[model samples]
Target: MSDKELTTKKYWEAYYKNSHVNKQHILTVCSYYSPIWEIFISNSEVSKSLIEIGGFPGRYLAYLANRYNIEPTCLDYNSDLTQIEGSFMEMDVQHYHIIKEDFIKFKPKLKYDYVMSNGFIEHFKNYDDILDLHVKYMSENGRLLVMIPNMKGYIQFYKYLVDYKNLKIHNLKCMKLKVFEDFAERHNLSILHLGYYGGFPLGIHQKINFLQKIIYKLHRLVFKYFANDKLKKYPSKYFSSAIVGVFEKQ
Candidate 1:
């Protein structure tokens, strides 16, 4: 499956139907980005408004609400979202709101202090349009946080060579840091930070074969036993599985 096919609602719905992993908890998402969020939120004050695009379940936003006291909002088109065990409606955090609509066409009367998306941009060939929409909702000096699979990184190289069959189902674009730089230039966004970090490996998804599953477990064990905590804070295209960028509107 190409990234195009993988991003379709049909594929994701089917994928979600079979997966029960991190579906119900904000802890997983918050813990994964704790280092990145620490840096991103360091100089900023709490209570800043934030909106997450396509952040279904809204667990991370809920976590932010609890951790930073920031007002949280999420935009998604999942009308049946309440059926999910961990959807936004289930989170206990206060001041968390949901806008159930197509994110591309969503327009709010009030702008946000921060805009975020994880694993979102790589889905569409027209990433510019989607990114521009995120920017349009940001207040002046507002920040944008985007996280995606690192196509140009060493992890991808390993996957291509070792788990080539499993990798094909992901349908991720070969997006490099430069692609984001281009978007920043075109949109009057300044690159505050850009780097790679550890993330969920490809083979853990439900569609992978048994051999890929073994490889995934082995990769997790290696990271658990041998990875350096400090070094993991620094982004390396050659080593990190995920790329993260923090941008500020100029």
Candidate 2:
């Protein structure tokens, strides 16, 4: 499957249907969004306002609502998307230009302090389209936090070892900070802060508590024990399974 196909509503919806979008998943979204602080170092107060483009199940929305006394709106094409405690709505982000509906249509009246997303941009065939949308809706000096997958990670490299290497990861191509900086500049935005992390896919594993230590330990042990040593050429960290960037509209 190509990156475009993998990010389709059909694919994402199917995955959401299968996976548990529980508290652990919510924490994972918060973990990625929390890093936006690096973008606005001057802000003495904690984060308050935020907007999540692909706010599936409202996990990040919940996080923002619980943390700060602010409302976070979630927008997606899927009307069936889970609505949590925070503000929730369904609209095609890309086509908001046509309908002149949804939040973006009236964004001038409803600006935010920050804009955040996780594992959403790479799904698009091109980030340029999405970046423009983000730029239009983002407030001046408001921060944009984006998480793009870094395919060079061990998980992807290992697929080359197994037979599942056929899937193309085009999103990895634009994972560089340069790509983001270029986009931000084109839209008159600045790279206030940027970094790449997610070495071991540990971001998700961090959800497990000490009570689940035995389960996590056994799982790792099984892989280390039976896994091909040749496949383990990379260290525990692959450096770029995902890239997170925070930008401010200049």
Candidate 3:
């Protein structure tokens, strides 16, 4: 299938249905070690409202709601979001909403204080269209937080070695910080923070064979023992796990 077809609602629905649900909470994912968390905490204030675009099985959204006591909303094309809703409840997040609609057609009744998407926009061919939707739902001076896999670096090389098909689904060009900076400039959004984040992450987002699994494990060991702290402090575009941007509408 073409990249366009791969990013369609039908494709995503099927992908989510077939994939196992991640019951792991965001905190357990070592989020504090990454710059993404730092940017989030530094830019966010308590009691602000946030809407997560295309955030199905909203673990990250739940994390934000629980951590900051923020009202949260999750919007996605996926029909069954009971898992995500349950997560919110389990986390004791009282004020949260889940909208089962395509983000392209979603019209919010009120703009949110923050609009966010985790690994969402890179699936699209048109980065501006996806970003415009995020901007459309934000209140004036609201912040937009976007995080995408750093697929242009060694991660891309690793994916090419073991998960080329999965890599193809992502728009590698969108992973660049320049793309976001250009978008922010055109849209009159001030860049609060923009850079790569995290240590070398072991991306198991796709299925791999036995040998590939062993290699992945070895890589995880290497990163954990030697590279984690250094990379976390100075996340380079060549090896950092994600590219993150925090922008405020100006």
Clashes per candidate, residues 3 or more apart or on different chains: 2, 0, 0
CA lDDT, candidate 2, residue 226: 51
Cα lDDT of model 3 by residue, 1-250, tens digit: 3444337777777766643334455567535634555565544454688898988777778777777778889988788777677767666787788888777666778898888888888888887777877888878778899988888777888778777888898888788888998899889998889888888867666778998888888888888889978998889898888888999878
Q: Among all windows of ten consecutive residues in candidate 1, which has the lowest summed lDDT?
A: 82-91
- Per-residue lDDT over 1-250 for candidate 2, one digit per residue giving the tens place of the 0 to 100 score: 3444335556556545643445656666566545454454344466456667776666656655555534566665544443332222221111111112233233444666777777776655766666667765576677787777665656555433331322353455565668787877787777766666533332231234474555446545655455424323432324335666778766
Model 2: worst 10 consecutive residues (lDDT sum): 91-100
Q: After superposition, how far is residue 51 of candidate 2 from its true place, in Å?
A: 1.3
In model 3, residue pairs whose N, Cα or C atoms come closer than 3 Å (at least 3 residues apart or on different chains), thus clashing, are: none
For each candidate, what is the lDDT?
Answer: 0.68, 0.54, 0.78
Better by TM-score, candidate 3 or 1: 3
Overall local distance difference test of candidate 1: 0.68
Clash count (model 2, backbone only): 0
**In lDDT terms, which candidate is top?**
3
Better of 1 and 3 by lDDT: 3
- The full ranking of all candidates by TM-score, starting with the best, is 3, 1, 2
The positional error of residue 249 in candidate 1, measured at the CA in angstroms, is: 1.8
